[model samples]
Target: MRSPSIAAAASTAVLMTLASASRGQTTGGFSLDRFEPAPAGDAFFGVPSPAAPGHLAPRVHAMLDYAHRPIHSSGDSPIDLVSSQALLRLGASLALWDRLLLSLDAPLAVAQGGDDPGIPGVAFTELTAPELGDLRFGARLRVLGRDAGPLQLGIGGYLFAPTGTPAQYTGDEEPRGAFHASLGGRLGTARSSLGFLWSASGGVELGGGPNRPQQLTFGAAAGALLGGDLLQLGAEAYGAAPLGGDLLLSSTPVQREEAGLNAELLLGAKLRVLGGLTFGAAVGPGLTNAIGTPSVRAVGMIGWAPLPQPDSAERAPAVAAGDKDDDGIDDALDACPDVKGDPSPDPAMDGCPPADRDGDTVRDIDDACPTTPGARSADVTRSGCPDDRDGDGFHDGIDACLDVPGSSSDDPRKVGCPADADDDGIVDASDACPKVKGTASRDPKQNGCPDDPDGDGVRGAADACPNERGRPDPDPAQNGCPRFVRVHADEITTSKPVQFIVYGKTRAQTVAPISDDLLREVRDAIQQNPDIELVEVQGHTDDSGSEEYNLRLSQERAEAVLSWLVAAGVPREKLVARGYGFERPLGDNRVKTGRQKNRRVQFMIIKRKGAAVQR
Candidate 1:
């Protein structure tokens, strides 16, 4: 049978270990404070060292600990003592604001056992009962760094209440208070794969209970992050030395007296299983002879914070699915879903600009002259404004003298004070001989007169054929005439192709109808230029469908156009039709707009000897 004093003392040691662990001190038991094993994963089963990181959210942690001591001594006995203890602790902490944290911990002594010698101060024989432990509440305020820094500092105070059966060594059976300051920091680089942390704390307890002597306690811990912060291996050394008080045999001896030191080698792992839930485990063995230090200790824990979950039920059912723009894209995925537009890679421009109805680069909301077409520019005064090359109020589109500044006017044809190059009263646009001054006449055609280049007797402005000399006729239209006709190559070839509207059962093989306006132009050109021998009408199409089919279609279309021209008035001998098909695409066929421009008919003027060719 063990002495009551010895049993009490050993049990007290077990209780002390449990208390230290719950308080996040390294003395014994499992510290339930906040220690981050990884940057994102915190220690779940052990009290965080003073150097641990601070959190922004509230967290609850629960841990189960099992400790076994193969050998221990209480100074009263020369024989070695053996014991086992189990503790269940529940702790919660919340960061009230900034770096301030409030925490509470409660533990239950599930089981305890050992060889008892019935020492004088022992309170119980063999362990056979389970009971509640003391309750500890604390507030920690970080004075220095909270989340990240080379060094972190904090000050904290805790209150302990007698809530357990003292006979079972669960508590001191009295109220006690303690104040402490902690300084900790990280060594090596957190940015590096491997790093280390060092923490130390010291404080004094104040109370009058037999177990609550006014003593000083201090602890230090060092740990290293391994395997990319997945594992933490460290060591801790801590103890309490009585300063001045009546000798409290049970409580004080369990934590060591005067200047005794306890050491432990620890290993732990933490895993972030969910958004804000973490699970961890730690196991270690004591390396020094200390009253409360256990030979081997193991702990398992689970921690959770509610605020990190975004997909929780609380947030569901509040979002709606709809498309406001009717652009085939949903509002949830569209950047500018309110306005209809095609898909674009840029999020800001994912939809069409609402105010730019005409698809102009300038937005109508900022465009001063919204109705008119203009260029986009970075110049503050000119941006979104109509092009006024000469800084004149009138836009170039309406200004007759585009290169010179002039006053604005209501006349549509006389914008920018239409220039008279020859100093003629009439503007260049109205003057037939703009470079030479002329006299006005009653005839509208002769209003702006000029010298007759052909010496046709009639003025150049009134002569129908100013370049050719002819006998003056009574009728103004036939005053000047040319005996033979001539035409320039440039007059036949135009920038815009002759468009044909095709209609048939098959789009590719359809016979296209030539425009009457185009036919008239071709006929007039041939008639005026009697010297022109041949005119080749070439047809081309975009790359689509069968190449052979496109070639045949192109040839047929070219022939159709030439036939229409011939029927309109052009002689067959002067016309030749050919097809280049999809091989002569003028633009990219992959896009809709490019393909539209690629389908066209081209006119090439072939002149005989002595006739000038523009090319």
Candidate 2:
């Protein structure tokens, strides 16, 4: 099944091929095998692992490889494109120092067979004899990392020479080369039970001439060492495409695989029969019908590969590392870097082993009350102690409320003591008016419950003067009030200061007539409240005077006021006077303002409506 038009075109192509071959030249295309193998560790049949086992010393390598039908075609009837070919390759590699590797290989096509159509201009185009392929030499240099480490990088290139027969389709006519960047890494070690490595390369293949297209070449390989380092298995893929030129990763390489992926895949196994002597075989198929990509391929290889001795890093460290804790584990891996203890995985406790003496989860180092079991807390001081929010003697659990101090109670259920809702001494449990702050009372029923927050004994809301001390008054309008020494209130609530003029120096300081008006107001207020109980005229002085002089001076002032009240028809038996030498100051006596308030006479009502309410 051959069309005349296609056969004519094929004949023209053949004539051109013959014309080129006669001059000992080729179209510089269709050379199949691309060999670039790493010099050390494990290697695949074609593309190699980018690893060099050891580089301390120079290492030499040799290989003999045979491939079946690595370059062939199909379905071209009378003009039968070659169906099979046998190839033999001999190669060698040498690695220098820990960086550079050099290699060379020469291949021979032993036999190639295909059909020939009797078309004009193409009569002698069929292949029948053995031929030689191009000669290849290559070199690579380490760019980063230790050659054998898990992340080494390298860059290299291969040079091709026109050393084979042009008729066999195995060589490029013009000198050419390919350059690439390679990356990969190896894990474990040759001495270890297991070792693995991987490599990938990408670069450009130089074109020989106008007829030969420059291609983007790529390869990937992975290999492993097993059977205690005696056996190796690997797989690899290598390809080239002019259409994929340069942008291999950014472009749709996946689409190339679906459409025209020109690559061959190989899987092989190698075994070391003797020291440095490895024998291997591989088989695979081409992914697309590009030049040199065969329908099916098989390869066999025999080689001597020896690894170099590892460097000092593979041995014990030269110097002693710091270990302040004296733990067997190195400080680097220790959870508690400075603490002498076991290792831990947590960074907070790493190297420092977890320890809690009291069996609480809280670490002893951070626990405040180390001996006692406690809850976790933001406060380092009490982290390990029972929760005490308000700082009361009772634990938070027994305390009815948190963040509020409570009193100690006889009741077990109320161990937190008195849970005073208000800041008064009386516990809210006993205080009927819990919200009202008040003083303690002898009678529980009439205690803080009645809301005598001022404790002046004016129970309920009737006491116009709440906080200050007060007494029951005979005046209905101002009953249970404290403040203003006025007749309207019937009690000495407050008034202008009682001014006095003292004349007697040696004779018990006489009260002058200068404070007469102020004294009369006090007398009038007391007279208006006949039902009022005993009233105590308290005198006080600032700290400016000596204690003895202030007491004597204040006593005279209080007695002066008291005598005025008794003279104004007030019962003398119902009144008493006392002088306190700056002892119960209503304000700080250090300042002039406070001293002014201190040097004053106070009419204190020793009176209360509630029998239990006390000053």
Candidate 3:
């Protein structure tokens, strides 16, 4: 016979179960119908759902479940019973390590109600109750699948503590444990609008309690993600079957049989919000005729998994200490902490300027010539001076003549001085005749003088007859002289005069197209008449301007003609240059044609007899 207390407790449990169902609540315990929260959509119930290892952090979950059994038969009996149940549960889970997870949960039977028959051979079965349920703790370890892989596998176990009162139908009044293995995976497009996932699990429970039996539990679920996983819809099918146990009848004597198979088909939806918060709900109907299985069940849950915070020790040292410029130097040690720079011994300069690749004191930013080695100087213009390519004391930029060695003066004209413009080995500034090709000379005035083309003893510039062979003379005027002038006796018998046309307005104006033939003729005459002792070059011009000017002009023309003949291999000592004003004319001065003829130079010849000749 059963004790009154036990009978009353059973009756109370039945009433509570019915009330809980009416209130949309269900009790939690070692039951085939319990749900497990997991990363996959199928995790709504009946499986050790596989998850990518370390993909999620610790989380807390709250769930409410309601179950209704409008009709249920016990064993082979035809009698039926109606009941409602409600339960609220709180749970937490954490990834303890690489592929390991630990979780704990507690449930409260909040409401239940149903019709109840007194226990066999017992009375006073009416009751009232709201009580705590079992405490569940579990660990899950991933056996396969990395965080980013499509296939995942895991094995785990759960321990249930009988923490509920029997009167509430919230617990089995005995401890229980379960071991499970699960496989899960995602299909379709991950992180896309059409992504999907599926999960499946199987496990065995070691039953320990009066009338309880060892059981096999298996489940599978599939889901589609809408709105990028913000919303999920899924369905699950799960079942449990007893492996072995003694046949037992209900304490009320309504039926007698061994444990039967229990199964359900559930559809669920979850909405993820606030990045880490998830709200979910599910409903399903029983698929079997098991005594304890409800005809319809529904569940609602809210879960949160706050993002993990990095520990100080786990954070990078540079980031933790603050490298504002990301230069690997902390702000405290960086002179220009906010700007990128380099390491240096000087506190004020370290990290303060851009890199200097050649170890030059000048930073590359301010160094105009950065690559080649240089020096710092007070001249800002040459602060980053390039190497002197010519081995000159002055560096490149300041030195105008870069490729050749020169002076160091900054004066535009003097700087880079002593350059050999003609490359004659003589420096240009000291070169009297810089442009002409020449040679070094001991005489400063004649230094860099052009070659003596005629092989004359004197240098070119100082030689009076530079292009002709001649002997040196003490007199500057007769320095390079030919011996004598040969002339015809008839030419010396009279004063011979050469005529010319005056083109310039002044006597000193330059003349164009002087007759080389005429000059050569005069030179030949001088060479032919060797008996001529002396020659006089006289000037005469037409009266075109003032008498004074005309006289000067005539005299210049005479001197020019004399110089021309002397330069054309004539004897310099035997020649004289004279300029006569326009005082004598051979033609009418007032006539344009006559004035042209009169504007002329005349040469006079004298014999060794000292007699002057007139033409």
lDDT of each: 0.59, 0.61, 0.61
Residue 150 miss distance in model 3 (angstroms): 0.8
Q: Least lDDT summed over 10 consecutive residues: which range in candidate 2?
A: 247-256
Better of 1 and 3 by lDDT: 3
Query: How does model 1 score by TM-score?
Result: 0.41
Count the clashes in each prediction: 20, 17, 32
Q: Write the residue-wise lDDT of candidate 2 on 251-338 in tens digits.
A: 1111011113458788888887556677778877777654446666777766777743344556534434666787665665566657
Question: What TM-score number comes out for model 3?
Answer: 0.45
Off by over 4 Å in 2: 1-42, 53-79, 126-129, 243-261, 308-615
Candidate 3 Cα lDDT to native: 0.61
The alpha-carbon lDDT assigned to residue 266 of candidate 1 equals 55
